[model samples]
Target: MADASHTSYLPPILIFCAGAVIAVPLFRRLGQSAVLGYLAAGIAIGPSVLALVNDPDAIRGTAEIGVVLLLFLVGLELQPSRLYSMRKDILGAGLAQMALSATAIGLVGWKFGLSVGGAIAVGLALALSATSIALQVLEERGDGSETYGRRTFSILLFQDISIAPALALLPLLATTGAQNHSGAPALAGLGLALLAVALLVLVGRYLLNPFFRILASTGAKDVMTAAALLIVLGAAMLMERVGLSMAMGAFLAGVLLADSHFRHELEADIEPFRGVLLGLFFMAVGMSLDLQLVFDNALLLALAAPLLVAFKIVVAATILRVSCSSSTEAIRAGALLSPAGEFAFVLLPLGAALGLLNTQQAALATSLAALSMLIGPVAAKLIDLWLSRRAGPAETMEEDFEGAGGSVMVIGFGRFGQVVTQALLLQHIPVTIIDSNVERIRSASKFGFRIYYGDGTRLDVLRAAGAGKAKIICICIDNREAALRIVEMARAEFPSARLHVRAYDRVHAIELMKADVDFQMRETFESALGFGRVTLESLGLSYDEASLVIDSVRDRDAQRMEIQYHEGIAAGIQKVPRVSPEPLVQPKAKSKALTEETREVIEDGGAEVAVGGVGEPER
Candidate 1:
C-alpha cells in the first residue's frame, strides 16, 4: 500500500516540473523578474494547491544549500585587493546601518512588551537587508563599479562574514538567555574561526591552485566540477561541526579559490545548478507564506511592511551620506539599498529556532521581507526617472567652433573606423575617436586605440569632439536608432561638414538619401560576399566565375537596392496626395499684391492659406 501511494504521487511532481519549464520563456518575455515567477509557481503547486512537496522542512533544507552556494560564489568574485580597497565603505556604512537599525528595532520591540534579549535578537534579524536583491538591482543598472556599487558591496560583505558569528551567538542568546559565552569554550570557538582563516590562507597560497592544475590536466570536465562541489560542501560540513554557519565554510572555500585561474571555469560549471537552486529557494519562501496568519493580522502586517523597509533605507542612506557623499550620489545610494533582501528569510527561521522569536514575530518579519523584495524594481525605476528629469533639455543650437588644427575627429571606431584612424595615424591625422560602451573603452585603451567616451547624439558632445570645423565627420554608430538621431543632430548643427554614414540595410540607404545627406555605404554586405568569392576560388571554381558571382551579388545589393528605394518612394507618393486640391492663384503681375493681402490677413492672426506644390495636379 505504501509503495502504491508513492507511485500515485509521481504524476503531479512531473506536472510541476513541466510548469517550471513553461514558466522560464513566459517570464522572460513579460519582463517580469524570474523571482516572481518562481514564487507564483510554488504557490500554485504548494500544499494549499497541488501539494507537490508536502514536507516544508525538506524543501527548506534543499534551499538552505542554495544560499550556501550563493555566498560561496559571491566571495569568489571579491579579490583581496578589491576588498581591501573597499574597506572604508564596507566597514563604515555597513556597521553604521547594522548598529543603528538594530538599536531602533530593539527599542521598538521592547516597546511592544518583548523581553530585552528577545527584542534585541528580533531587532538584529530586522536590521540586515537582503543582499541578493541589492546585488541584482545593481547588476541591472551597469553601475556595479560605481561609488554606490562599491559601498553597497562592502556592507554586504561584512554582513555575509558576520552572519556566522551571529548564528553561533544566537543560540546562547536565545536558549540560555545570555549574550556572551563563558571563558574557555567561547575562546575555543573564536580561536577555531581564526585558525580556520589562517589555514585557508596558508593552503590557498601554497597548494589549492597547484592541486586544481593537476586535476585540469586530467582533462576530465566532471572531475573539476566534482572537486569544486566537494570543496564547498566539505568546508560547509566542517564549519557546521565547529558550531559555525555553512555560509562561513562555503565563503572560506571561495576565498581560497579567489586567486585561482580555474575560478571562472568553476563558476561557469556551477552556474546552471545555482540558478535552479535559487529558484527552489524562492519557491520555498512562497511555500512558507501562511495565508491564515496574514489575514488574521492584516493591520499589523500592513503597519510592519513599509516600516521595516523604510528603516533599512533610512539607516543605509544616512551611513552612505556620512561615509561616501555627494548629495546626488547619497540619494542614489539610499534609493538603491532601500529594498530588504533574501537574508531576512534565512534569518527568520534561525532566530525562531534559537528561541529569539515567536511564531507571530517571525511571520510578521517574513511578510515585510517579501514586500521589500517586491518593491526593488519600483524603487530603481524611480531613481532612473529622477536622473532623467534632472538632465539638461535637448540642445537645438549650433555648437561653438574652435579651430581643428591639431584635432582629428573620428566619428565611429568600429572595424572600419579603426582602419580609417590607423591610416590617418600613419600619415599623422592626429585623431580622436568617440565610443559609448565603458567596457569597450577600457579594452580599446589596452590595445592603444585613442577613444573618447560620449553618446554622439548630443550637440554638446559633438562640439567637444570638434564637429563644427572638422575636415570630415564619419558616422559609424552601428545602432540604427542612434545613427539616425546623430544624423539629425549633425545636419542641424554642422551643415558645412562632409558627412559619411554606415547604412544598415537597403531601406536605411533610402532613408539617408531622402534626408539629402548623401555619402553612405552599407557596412558589411559587399565584404562578406567578397569572402564567398575567395572561398569559391579555393573550391576549384574559375577566377572569372568567382568574379562574376561576386559582381552579381554586389550589383544586386548596391545598384538594384537603389532602384527599389526610389520605386518604393514613388509608390508611396502615388498612394497619398502631396497637396490638397484647393488653390487660389494669380499671375506674376498680381502675385506680390495677393501675397501682401494674405500677409495682412495673417497679421490679424488668421490661419494661413494652403497652396498646391509639385505633386498636386495643375490648378
Candidate 2:
C-alpha cells in the first residue's frame, strides 16, 4: 500500500495544473496577461474561495525556487560584453528610475506611520516592476526589438540585479537582525557567505564546462538536465547555509557560466523547469493573499491599488520621457511595468521577520500588490486605445484577407512589391499581394491591382492568405526585421514553398543567405548598377563599355559579400582598393551646378537650364 501522505498530495497537484491550463488561456483570450491568470487561479483554489488548499505555506517554499531559477536565466543572458554595451541604458535610465521611484515611494511610506527601515523595504519592494510579465507581454506583441522595448528591458534587468543587495539589506535593516546578533556567529556566517560566492565562481569557471562535457558525451539528455539543476540548487543551498538568499547564489552561478560554451544548452535544459516554477511562484503568492483582510479593508485597498498604479505609471513615464523617448513609448513602458512584482513576496516576509512590519501589514502590502497587478491589464488596454488614435486610420485599419488566395503570394505592396507584382502580371501569373497599409491597398485598387490587408509576420494571416498552397513566398516588406521573420516562418511552416526576399541592405542579404533563402536581392542593387551604367554611357563610354564597368563593380561587390559571409563584415573592407579621397570630377576647380535635381516646370517640357561654370556644356 502507498503511504497516505504521498497519496494525499496528488489532488492538489492535479488541481494546480488544471487551474493554470484553463485560467491562463482564458485570460489571454480576453486580451489579459498570463500573470493575472495565475493569480486568479490561485485565489479560486485557495481557502479564500474553493478551500481546495488550506495551507499556502505548503507550496511557498517550493515556489521560491522558481525565483532562483529565474535569476539564473537572467544571469545567463547578461554576458559581460552585452552588459557593457547596454551599461548606459541600464545604469542611466534603470538606476535613475529605481532611485527616484524608491525615494518617492519611501517618503510616502514614511509619512504613513511606518518606521524608517519598514519604509525603505516597502519603497524598494514597490519600486520593482515584474520582469517576467513585462518581458512576456513585449515578446507577445512582437516589440521586443523596438526602441521602447529595449529601454523597458534595460530597466527591468537593473531591477533584477538589484535583488541581491536588496535581499542582503533586509537582514541588516531588521530590528534584531544582523546587528543585534552581531558576534562570532554573525561573523562566521558572513565569512561563509563570501566563501560560498568564491567557491561558486571557481567551480563555474574551472569545473562546470568539463563536467557538462562529460555528461553530454554520455548521450543522455536527462543527465545533462539533472546536472544543470544540481548546479543551480547546489549554489542556492550553499548561499542559504551562509546567510544569503538562494537567488543571490543562483545569479552568481549563472554569471560564471554566462560566456561558457554550454550557456545555450543550460538555458534550453532549464527553461521548462523555470517556466513551470515561475508560474507556481505567482500562484503561490496569490494563494497566500488574506482575502479576509482584503474584504475587511476593502475601502482602503480600493483607493490604494489604483493610486499605486497611477503613481508608478506617472513616475515611470516621467523617467522615460526625460530619456528622449516619445510620449507613446513612455506611456507604454509605464503601463506595462507599473506593478509590484514577485520581489514583494520575498521582501515583505523578510521585512516581517526583521520587525519592520507586522503580519497584518505584510498581508496588506501583498494584497495591494496583487490588486495592482490585476489593474495592469486594463491599463495596457487603455494605452492601446490611445496609440490607435495616433496611428491614423490608414495603418490602424483591420486586416481582412477574405477570398484572397493565389499561386504566388507577395507579403508587401509598397514600391518594390508593386513593381514585382507588375512583372508577375506581365507573365499572366496570378499573384496575391498583402500589406498592412490600408491606404496603400486603396491606391493599388485604383491602379487595377487587388491587394489585401495583412501582416506577413503573423503566421495565421499568412495561412489565411493561402501561403500554404502557394509555390513561392515573396517577402517584399520595407521593414527588414519583418521580412526576416517571414523568411523564418516560411522555412518552418511552409517548407514546400520557395522563399524569395527583397533584402534591405548587404547585411540583410547575408542574413537571408544564412537563413537558407532560395533567392534574395538588395532592393537597390540591380537598379543602382543599371543607373550607373547609363551614367557612364552619358559620360562618353559605349553601352558595351559601360556594361563592362558595371560588371566589374558587381563582380567585386559579390566577391566582397562572399568574404563577408564566410568571415566577417569587416573582412570585406580589404577588397576595396585604397585611393585618393578627393572628388574625381572636381580636381582643382569649383563649379556651379544644380544643387537639386530639376523637375519639370512645364507640362511635357523640360526646365530651362542655368549654367554659371566655365566648363558648362552647350545645350
Candidate 3:
C-alpha cells in the first residue's frame, strides 16, 4: 500500500521534469529568458492545457518555498552596511514608485467601473512588481549588485514590506465594514509583525551562530543542509504568522546571518534547492494563471495589461529620475519593474474577503496580475533591444594583421599605449600594434607606424593581431572595463602569451591581479609617485632624501595593493599608511623638521575609494 501510494506521484513528477528538460534548454538556445520557458512549460502541462497536472494550487504551495529560499540567499549577499547604503532608494524611490504607480493604475481601474475602494485595491495590487521574476532576471544577468540592480531591488524590498500594510488597509477601504474593521486590529497586527522581526533578529544574533557551530562539529553535511532549510522555512512560517510574505521572512533571516561565519556554508547548502524550487515556482505561477479568465475578458486584459505596464514604467522611471538615477538606469528600471508581482495573488483575494472588491473584480485583478508577470520578461527584453538600438554600434575598422606575430603584441594606440610602444621599440624588439580607433589608426599610419585596426575585445581580432604567436600581449586601454574584458578574452584566447596590462587605478590593479595576469601596472601610479618625488625635491629637499621618501611610499602602496587583492580596498586603509610612521632621521637622536607640504599630505591621509576604479564605476 505504501509503495503504491508513492508510485502514484511519479507520473506527475516525470511530466514536470520532462517539461523543464525540453523547454528550458530550447528557450535558452532561442535566446529567450528561462523564466519565460518555465512559464510556457507550466501553461502547456497545466490543467488549462494538456491537463497532465490538473491542480496547480497543489504544487503552488510547495513551489512557493522556492521564493522563500531565493530571498534567504539574496539576504546572504547583503551586509547591513550595504543595505544601509540603499536607504534612499528604498524610501525615496521605492515609496514614490508605489504612490505614483498605484495612483495611475487606480485611475484606470476607476475608469473601468470599479468602485473607488476596488480601484485603489486593484491599483495597489498591480503596483507591486513580481519580485521572483525581477530577481531571477537580475541574477541571470549578474546585475544584482549593480547600481541599477540595487535600485530595482530596493523598490522590490519595499513592496514586499508593504504587503502587510496593504492587507490592513483593505478593510478600511471597504464600503461595508461589517466585522467592525478598525485601526486597532491594524495597529495590533503591526505590533505583532514588529515583535516577530525582533525575535528573528534576537535568534540570529544570539543563537544561530552557536547552533551552527555545534552542528558543524558533528561533521554532518546532510544535517547542515537540513538546518539551512529549517531556518528558511522557520523564518518564512514566522512572517506568514503575522500576515507578511514568507519570502520577506526568509530575507530577514538571511540578513541576520549575513555577518555570521556560517553564511557561505548555508548559502552553498541552499543554492541547489533555491534553483530547482525557483524553477518550480515559475512553472507553478504559469499553471496558476487562469487562461480561461484571460480569454473571457480578452479585450479588458489586452487593454489593461499593456496600459498598466506603461503606467508602471512611467511612474518607476519618473521616480528613479527624481531619485538621481542615470537616464539609462531610470529607463531600464522603469521597464524592469513594470510587471505586477506575485503579491497580487495574495492581496486581491484578501480585498475580496474584506468586501473591498467583489468576486468578479478580484478574479479580473488576479488575472491582470498574472498576465503582467507573463509580459514582464518580454517587456524587459523589448526595452533592452530598444536601448541597444538607440545606443547604436561601436565604430570598427577593417582588421589586417599580415606579416604580424612579433615577439610583443601591443593592443592600444592611446597615449598610454604609444608610450608603452616607445619603450618596447627602445628595446629594439619587433612589436605588433592593434587598435580599433579608425582615426587613431589613420594617424598612426601617417607616422609610419604599422598599427593594425582591430577591437581587442573580440577573440578573432586578438588572433588576427598575432596574439597566438606573440610571446607577450600588452593591454593599455584607458577604459577600465574594456581593459578587464580584454584581459579575460586574451587569457582565454592566447594561454601561451604572457599578458601585461595597464590598469586605471588601485581598484583596477586589484582586479587585474585577481585575473592572474602576468603583469599589471596602474598608468598613474608611477607618474604620480615621480611627480611627488620631484615636488619634494623642489621644496628644499635633496634628491636622495626625496627618493628615500618616494621609495617608502611605493613600498606602502605595494603593501596596500596586496591587502586590496585579498580583502578589498576597505581592509587596506589602516594596514598600509600613505607616509611612513618613522621619521627620515631617528627621532631618538634628532627631531626631524617636517615640511608644511608633507604635513598637509599626512593630515588627509586615508580616504574611501570608489569600487568602479579610475574615478568611475565600471558597472
Candidate 4:
C-alpha cells in the first residue's frame, strides 16, 4: 500500500549502506584509511560498475549537505581564541601556500594552452587540499593537537574562508560581456555576502544559545538534536539563497556557538550525523568519477594527478620547513595535505559556467583531482618512511633509550604516569616513560622529564621504551580499550615485567584480572575508601580505630574481587555461607600455583594497596 515512488528510493540507500558496511571494516582491517574504503565502495556500486545507483546527481545533492556539516564541525573545534592565537600562521603560511601553489598551477595550465582566466581557475581549484580527509587522517594518527596538525588546519581554514570570494570572482573571468558583470555588481555581491555573514554571526551570538538552553531544559535529547540540525540547515539555506556557499554559512554559525556553554552538547548531538553524511560524501565523490574519461586518458590522468600532488607537496614542505625548522614536521604537513580538495568540484563547475573551462577540461580536471585524493594516504606513508630513514636509526627512541635502562616503564605520561614518575624519581629510582600524544611529550620535556613518544600497545614501541629491562610496567592510560590493549601486550611480550594497570571501574578491573595482570587498581577505589576514613575520623573515631575498620573493609573487598575473578559472582557468593564467623582474608601463604610477580607485590604491601587512579597520570 506504500507509494511506488517512495519504495523505489529505498534500493539506492540500501545499496550505499550495504557497500559502506562491507567495505569500511575490510579496508580498516587491511590497514587502509576508511575514507578510501568509502570511495571504493561508491565506485563499486556506482553507474560505471554495478549500476546500483544509476543517477549520481541525486546522491550528490544529499552528499553536499555532508560537506556543509563537516565544515560546521571544523568550526566548532576551532574556538575563536585558538584561531586568534594561530592568526600569524594562518595569515603567513596559509596565504603563502595559496598564492604560490595557485601561481605554479596556473602557469602549468597556461602551458597546456588554456586562457589566462581558465588557468587561474584551474590553479585555484587545485591549490586547496581536502579538509575532511586531512582532518580524519590526523585524528586517526592522534596528531590533531600536534604542531604539524595545527599548521595544516591553519591552511585549510584559509581555503575554506576563501571559497566565497573564489565563487564571486569566477564570473568576472568570463570573456563574454553578457556573462561578465561590471565591477559595481561584483562589489554589491561582496557587500551582500558580508551582510549575510554578519547577520549569521549576530543571530548566533544573541539568539542561538538561549534557544538551545530552552530546548535542553525540556530534557528531551531528541528535541535538542533536532534543534541543532535546524540551526545548521537553516543557516545553510540562508547562505544558499543569498548566493553564498552553504558550508561558509554553517561554519560561521559553528564558530559563533563554539564558545557557548552548550558547545559540547551541540557537538555530541551533531557528531553521528556528521560522520554518516561525511561517509556518504566521500562515496559520492567516488561515484562522480568519470571512469570512461579516466580510461580513455589514463596516462594523462596518471601524470596530471601525481604532478599536481608533487608540486603542492614541495611547496607545502618548503613553507613548513622555513617556518617550523623541522624536516619531519615539514614532510608530514606536505604529504598529508597534497590532495586536491572537495572544493574542486564546486570550483570546476563554476569555471565551466563562467566560460573558463570547457566540458572536456572540467571533466579532465575532476578526474585528475579524484585520482590525486585516491593516492593521498599512500603518498603520506611513503613520505613518512623516507623522512624516518633520513633521520637515521640513531635518532629513533629505541636507540636513544638503549643506554638508559630503568626499573619502571610508564606506558602513558599523562597525569597518572607523571605522578608515578615523580614518585619514583623522588626515591632515586630510574624510570622510563612513553606517551603517544606529541603535545604531552613536548610539555613534559619542558618540565625536564625525558618522556618518549610512541604507542605502548605496539610490542616494538614497548621494546623501544626499554620494556624488556623494566621490572614494573605501569599502564596509566585513561582510555579503557587502550588500557586493556597495553595490559595484553605487556603480559605477552614481557612476561618477566610486572604490569600495574589502572582500571576505570569494577568491570574494567575484572577484565584486567581476567587477563592475569599482576595488579589492577580501580581508578576511584582507593580515593573513595580514603574519603570514608576521613568521614569516620571527623565523626570522633580514633585514627587507629578508623584505620583498622578501613583495612578490614579493604581486605574483605579484595577477597570478594578475587573470588569474582575466577568464578562467576553467583558461584563465588555461594562459596561463602551466611553463618560464617571468621573474617575473609586472602591466605598469606603462597597458593598452589600463584604467579611469581603477583605474589611479590601482594607480599610486599601486605595487601594489594594502590593509590587513587581518578586523575590523569602526571606529565
Candidate 5:
C-alpha cells in the first residue's frame, strides 16, 4: 500500500511536464504568450477540469521556488546604476501608481461593505501589475526600449519593491481575535525586519563575493551551480525566518550580485531552474482557482474582473498621460499593465490566513485576478488596433512627399535615422526624411518636423525624394536585405549619388562593402567604441588619453575591414564596386609616444594594459 501510494504521486508530475511541453510551443506558434499556455494547462488538468492533480498544496509548496528564483533573476537585472538612472520613473511614476491605484480600489471595496483595513489591503494588492507578463509581451513586440516600455517597467519595478511592505501590512490589518498583537510588538517586528534587511545587504556586499570566488576557483561547473543555488536558498531561508518574504531576500541577493564578475555565469546556471519553476508556479495558481465558485458567481465574477481591470487601466493611462508626452504611449502603457500580477496569488492567501479576508472573498479575488491575466494580451491587441485606426489618415498623407526634394535624402527615419536627420537639420542643411511608419510621421509633424511618408525601398519613392539631384543618400533602415537592395538600386540608377548604408552587424557590413556602397557603418560599432573609451576614463585615464586610445583602435579596425574586403574578393566573392567618392575627413596624425609592446597589442586586437603606472601603456 505504501509503494502504491508513492507511485500514484508520479502521475501528477508527468501530467504537468507533458502539459507544459505541449502547451507552450502551441501557444507560441499561435503568436500568444507562453504564460497563457502555462495557465491554460493548469486549468485544463486541475480539479476544475480533469482533476489529474489530487493534492494542489503539495505542488504549490514546490512551485513557490519559482517565485523566489524569478525575483532573484529580476534583482540581477536591476543594477544600482541603472536603477538610479531611472529614479524619476521608479520613485515618481511607480510610487504614484501604487498610491493612486490602491486608494481608488480601496474606496471601491469600502463601498462594497468591506472594512477599511481589509479594503486597503485588497486595494494595495490589486494596485500591483504583473512584471513577468508585461516584460515578456514588450520583449516579444520589440518595444522594450520604447517610451511605453520604460514607463511600464518603472511601474512594475515599484510594484516589486512594494511587495515587502504589502506583506508586512497584512497582519496588522487582520482583526481576528487569535491574531491580535500590541503596537509595541508591531514596532519590534518592524525593527527586526529592518535588521534582517541590513544583514542581507552587508553579507551580499562583503561576504558573498569572496564565498563565490573560492567556489569559482574550484573550477567545477556543478560545484559552482550548487553554490549559486545554496546562496539563493540560504538567503530565502534567512528571510523566512525573519518574518519577511523569501522572494524579497532572493531579490536582494540578486541585486548584490548584479555587478559581480560571475553575474553572467550565475544567470546561466540559474535561468533554466527559474523558467521551469515559474511555469510550475503559474500552473499551481491555475489549479487553485476554484471554478465552481466562479460558475456560481458568474455574473459577479464577469462584472468584477472587467471593473477591476478597467479601474487599473484608467489609473495607469492617467498617470502616463500626465507624465509622458504621447497619448498613444499612455494608452499602450495602460493596456500592457492592466493585468493582475503573480504576487496577487501570494497576497490574497496571506490576507485569508490573517483573517483580513474570509475564504469566500479570497476565492472571488483569485478568480478575478486570473481572469484579468487572461484579458491582458487581448487588451494589448485591441489597443494596437485602435492606434492603427487613429493613424490611418497620417498613413495616407504621403502626397506631401511630391514637393519634397533636397541635397540629402534620408530614408527610414527610425531611432538611427532620426539622429542623422536632426544633426543635419541643426547644421542648417536641407534634407528630406522618408519613413513608412504613419504614427512616427504624424508625431514628427506635431513637433514641427517635416517628414515625408513613403516606403524608401521603392524606386518611385527615391525618385520622388530627388535621388538624382541629391549628392548624399543615407540608408538608415534596420532591415539588412532591404538596405542591400536599396544600395543596389541606387548604384544601378543614381550612381552619382554617394550612398551611405547602415549595416546591422559585421556580416551585414561585409555584404554592404561587397555591394560597393560608398560608405558603410556597422550600426553599434561606434557606440561600443564610445562605451570602451568611457570605461578607460572611469578607470583613471585622462580624457585626452582615452580619446587617443579610441582613435588608435578605430584606425586599426578600419585597416582590418579594408583587408577583409580585398581578401573576400580574392576568394571569389561577388563584387559590386561603385565610383569611389572623395574621403570625407582626413585622418589625424598618428601618435609616436606608444612603445613597441603597446603597438603589438593594438595590431593584434588586444586591450591595452597599464603595467607600472596608472594610465600608462604596458611595456
Candidate 6:
C-alpha cells in the first residue's frame, strides 16, 4: 500500500552513506581531502546508476542545513574587534578586491550577452573564493595562522558580510525588473540592517556575555551548545525576516558573542556538527551532479569553470601583490584562493529572484560554483608543489638559525603565553619568542621582551629559534592549526626537546593527544572552573563536600578517558600500522588465515560480550 516514490528514495541514502564510509579512508590515505572523496562517491552512485534522490527540493532543503552550519562557524570567527584590528586588509585590500573583481567580471558577463543585472550578479558570484576550502587548505599547509592566513581571512570576512545586502537587493531588483528597479526597498533593507546592528550592540554590550557567564556557572556543556545554536538560529531568522540573508544575521550574532568566556567552548561544541553537516551538504551537491548536462555542454562547462577561477586568482593576487612585496607571496595568495565559495550558492536563489538569472542559468551557475569548489583543492596542491620546487629544499635555510642563544623557544606571546614567559623570565631563563604579529612584536620589543617576527610552525623558523638546542619548546599559539603544525614539526625534527603546549580547551586537548602531544594543558581547562565553583561553595562552609565532589569527578573522568583512548588507539593500530622501516605489506598466508578467522568469529558471535574482565549479555 506504500507509495512507489517513497520506496524509490531510500536506496540513494544507503548508497551515499556506504560510499562515503568506504571512499573516505582510501582518499585520506592518499593525503586527499574527504570533500573530494565525497564528490567522487556521489558521482559514482548518482542517478545514472541508482537514482537515489530525485526530489531536488527535498535534497536542497536537507543540504541547506550544511550551509547554515558553515556560515554559523564563519560568523563565530568574525568578531568586530578582530575586523577592527585588520582594517587595512579588510577595508582596504578586501574592499578593493571585491569592487575590482565585480567590475571586471561584470564586463566579461556583459560581453557574453547577459543583461546588466545578470552581469553584475555573475560578476559578484565569480569574485567570491571559497573561504571554507581556503581556510582548510591553509591549515593543511601549516600557513593558516601565518600572515597570509590572517590577510586572506580578513578579505573573506568582508565578502561574507557584503553578501547580505547583495542578496537582499537581488530579490528586489528581480521583482521590479533590473532596468526599472527602485532604490527605496534597498534603503529599507539598509534601515533594517542598521536596526539589527543597534539591537545587537545593546544586547552584546549588556546581556550576551552576562547571560553566557550565568550559563557557564551551571557547568553544563550541552546547555552551552544549545544556547550557542539558539543565538545563531535566532539571528539568522531575524535577518531572514528583514529581507536580509541568514548568513549576515548569524555572523552578527557571532561577532556579538566573540569576546565571551564561553566563545571557545561554544566553538568546540559546534565544530564537529558543522563539519559533518558541511560534508553532507557537499555530498548532496555531488548527488545533484548532472553528468548529462556536462556531456551536452562539455566544452562550455570546461572553459567557464577554469576561466572563472583564474579570473578570481588574478584579481585577488593583484590586490595582494600591492599589499605584500614578494612575488612568491602574491602567487601563493592567488593560487590558494581561486575558487567560488558557499556565497555563490547563497547568491543563486537571490539572482533567480532578482531576474538576473533564469532557472537554467541559475542551475548552470550553481553547477559551475560546485565544479570550482571541487577542483580548488587540486589547484592549491599544484601551487604548493610549484612553490616547493621554486624555493628549493626548505632545509637549506638552516643558516638562518645562527646567533640563537636562547635555551627555550616560545611560539606565541598571547595572553596565556605572556604570563608563562614572564614567570620563566622571573627565574632568569633564556627564552626567545617567535610570533608573526608585527604590532605585537613591536610593542613587546618596546617592553623589552625577547620576541621575533616569524611563524613558529614553519620548520625554518623553528630552527632559527635553535629548536634543537632548546631544552623546552612551549607552543602557546591560540589557533588550532598552528598548534598542530608545531607539534608535527617538533615530533619530526626536535624529538629530544620537551614539548609543552597550551590547548584551547578539553576537546582541543583530545585532538592534540591524537597528534602525539602528550604534555598538553588546556588554556582554560575545567580545573579553574571547578575551583571557582568549589571556592564559592566553600564560602558557605561546604568546603570539604565541594572539594571531594570536584576531585571525584575529575579523577573518574580522567581514568575513564585514558582507558578509552588507549583502547581505541590499540584497535586502530591493529588495522593500520604506522610508518616502519619495512614495507607495510601483508603476507598471503596470514591474510587468508585472518579472513577465515574473522568469518568464523562472525558466524559464532552469539552468546556474550566481555570488557575489562567483565562478562555481559551481547545485547
lDDT (tens digit, per residue) of candidate 3 on 1-619: 9999999889988887898888889988977778888888888888778888986566666456666776677677666544565678888888888988888788888997988888888889999998777887876665554578879999987886676578657755663444555567666767888899899999999999899889989999889878877887899899989966687788787788776766655665666566577777777777777788889999989987888788788889888887788888888888889889776876787788777788888988887887887787888888877887899853445567788889999988899999989988889899999876777888888988888876676566677667889999999888676677677667755789888888886667776776678887777666766776678779877665566566556665666667655575444333332222232233133225656655454444421132234855432
Clashes of 4: 9
Model 6 scores a C-alpha lDDT of: 0.70
Clashing pairs in 2: none
* Runs off by more than 4 Å, candidate 3: 56-59, 111-117, 142-147, 167-176, 179-186, 242-245, 322-326, 393-529, 547-619
Top model number, lDDT: 5
Q: Backbone clashes in each candidate structure, one number apiece?
A: 1, 0, 3, 9, 0, 1
TM-score of each: 0.60, 0.68, 0.68, 0.65, 0.64, 0.63
**Which stretches in model 2 have alpha-carbon errors above 4 Å?**
25-30, 79-86, 174-195, 198-202, 205-210, 252-275, 389-619
**Candidate 2 on 525-560: residue-level lDDT in tens?**
777667766786798655555554555555556666
Which regions in candidate 5 have their CA more than 4 angstroms from the true location? 1-9, 175-180, 272-274, 388-619
RMSD of 2: 9.6
lDDT of 4: 0.76
Error of 6 at 176 (Å): 4.8
Return the TM-score for candidate 4, rounded to 2 decimals.
0.65
Q: Rank the candidates by lDDT, best first.
A: 5, 2, 4, 3, 6, 1
If both were scored by TM-score, which would come out higher, candidate 4 or candidate 5?
A: 4
Those runs of model 6 whose alpha carbons end farther than 4 Å from true positions after fitting are 1-16, 45-49, 175-190, 394-619
Q: Quickly count the clashes in candidate 6.
A: 1
Off by over 4 Å in 1: 1-32, 48-50, 175-202, 386-619
Residue pairs with backbone atoms closer than 3 Å in model 4 (clashes): 414-617, 415-616, 415-617, 415-618, 416-616, 416-617, 416-618, 417-617, 418-618
State the TM-score for model 1: 0.60
In model 1, the Cα lDDT at residue 493 comes to: 60
How do the residues 1-619 of candidate 4 rate in per-residue lDDT, one tens digit apiece?
A: 4799899889888988999999999988977778888989988887788878878577668567777877788778667645776798889888999999999998998999888888888999999899988888886776665688878888888887777678777766663334445667656767887788888888887888799889878999889777767878888888877777787677777777776667665765676576688898888888888898999999888888888889889999899899863888888998888999888877887788777888999888888888888888778867766776887642323224555468988878877678778889999898888787666777778989887777665555677778888999899988775676567556656789988888887767766666677777766666666776677669865555455555655776677666766577433332222111222232244235534653453446533343324464411
lDDT of each: 0.66, 0.76, 0.76, 0.76, 0.77, 0.70
